[model samples]
Target: MILEVATITLRSGNADEYVRVMPDAFPVLASTPGYIRHELHRGIERPDVFTLFVWWESVEAHNVNFRESDRFPRWRAVWGHLMEGAYVEHFAQVY
Candidate 1:
C-alpha cells in the first residue's frame, strides 16, 4: 500500500468554509477504485494549514484511477478555491 499526503494551505479566513465543504467533496474519494482510507489533520500552530493523508493500494491506483479520472475535476472544483498552495507526495512503509 502507499500513503498519499497532500499539504494544503488555505487563504486567510477560509478555513471554516473549507471544512464546511469538505464532506461534500469526500464522496469523490470514496468512489475511487483502490482507495483504502483517509484522514484530515489541521495544524496546531497554523490553522490555515492542513494535511490530508490518503491510503491507496498503490501510487498507480491514485494517479490513474483518481487523478486521471472525472473524480479529480469534481473534487478539485469543490476544494480548489480554498487552497492558496498545495503539494502531494506518495510514501511507502519502511518495514
Candidate 2:
C-alpha cells in the first residue's frame, strides 16, 4: 500500500472552517479507486497547520487515478479555498 501524507497550511482563522468542510470532501476521496482510508491531524502548536494521511493501494492510485481524475477538482472545491499551501509526499512501509 501507499501512504500519502500532506502537510497543509490554511489561511489564518480558516482552521475551523476547514475541519467543518472536511466531511463533505471525504466522499470524493473515498469514492476513488484504490482508496483505503484516511485521517486528519491538527498541529498542536500551529492551529493553522494540518496533516492529512491517506492510504491507497498504489502510488498510481493517488498520483494518477485520483489526481488525474475529474474528482480532484470536486474534492478541491470543498476546502481548497481555505488552504494557503501544502506539501505532499508518499511512503511505503519499511517493515
lDDT of 2 by residue, 1-95 (tens): 98999999999999999999999999999999999999999999999999999999999999898999999999999999999999999999999
Off by over 4 Å in 2: none
Please list the residue runs of candidate 1 whose C-alpha ends up more than 4 Å from where it truly belongs after superposition: none
- Pairs that collide in candidate 2 are none
Per-candidate total of colliding backbone pairs = 0, 0
State TM-scores per candidate. 0.97, 0.98
lDDT of 1 by residue, 1-95 (tens): 99999999999999989999999999999899999999999998999999999999999999999999999999999989989999999999999
Task: Judging by lDDT against the true structure, name the best candidate.
Answer: 2
Reference-based lDDT, each prediction: 0.95, 0.98
- Error (Å) of candidate 1 at residue 42 is 0.5
TM-score: model 1 vs. ground truth: 0.97
